[model samples]
Target: MSENRRAEVDAALADVDFEKFNYQVVFETTKGTIKMDLYPDVAPGHCKNIIGLTKIGFYDGIIFHRVIPDFVVQVGCPQGSGTGGPGYTIDAEFNNLPHETGILSMARTNDPNSAGSQFFICLGRVPHLDNQYTVFGKTSDAESEAVVLSIGDVETNHSDRPLEDVKITGSEVIVTEK
Candidate 1:
């Protein structure tokens, strides 16, 4: 199943001209809309994986499963828990990108190469995560950054799960000529 899904993703992205175009993922959530620009130059695999997932509606209706104040708001789990993925994992593409406010990075197990569909948006500067996680994108504007921080401020249980569901109602991958 994992391989099949991976093949599908690859086929979907086979015609993309990453160098001549820009890719962004716009997420419509219960809180508000947030747009993120992918850093394909730094993490092409992670960028492609996310774009592929979004294009296929993999993130629609997915809830933010984890939220940490002044840290990050996480989502993209199919089960609305921190344990599910899109059936496969991608290798880490750690780069020099700092994990500062509005930065988007992948969520994975202790294994460095275990990231799949799950990702998080930093609400504040998180230097410790720099070069540790794959930083593939970031909130495209101030409004988008504000929405992510607002989600981070939501009430949560001891486990960091949001008390009220913060869901991605829809998602779209926008490709524009550069």
Candidate 2:
């Protein structure tokens, strides 16, 4: 990471009010359940958009189309081809959060504000993505991290698609008590 990028991340983290923000979600996938803590302060629109999608079962039946072992496990594309979304786009909410292990981030094209329903879970620290993508949430604990790793470890083909379908069975939004 560049010095400038680190500085920007530091500024963003300094303003976090951990006690007041408690948006969270639990995703039940074929591999296991993973819980993530959403950051509305850093990415309000993206957080709300994910919550809205969850409430309407938008992620159900979605497969982990792009799973790279020790890197990331991406899903949330209704088309299951890494080219679909919720028929809408949200502005990028890049924050101080680095793309570390268990981080939940929005996936987009070259356009910064092109993210929609597609997202990915970081399996390890990835510094190259800092300030380039919107990180709206992350695994809240060791248990959730383990689940994400398990999903990332699935056997993948040349294109990084899981050999066996790893689908999101269900998802729900929960207000965490700060």
* lDDT scores in order: 0.92, 0.82
- Taking all chains together, the TM-score of candidate 2 against the true structure is 0.86
Q: Give the C-alpha lDDT of model 2.
A: 0.82
Worst 10 residues of 2 by lDDT: 1-10
Clashes of each: 0, 0
lDDT of 1 by residue, 109-162 (tens): 999999999999999999999989999999999999989989998999999999
Model 2, backbone clash pairs (residues 3+ apart or across chains), number: 0
Regions of model 2 farther than 4 Å from truth: 1-21
On lDDT, the candidate that comes out on top is 1
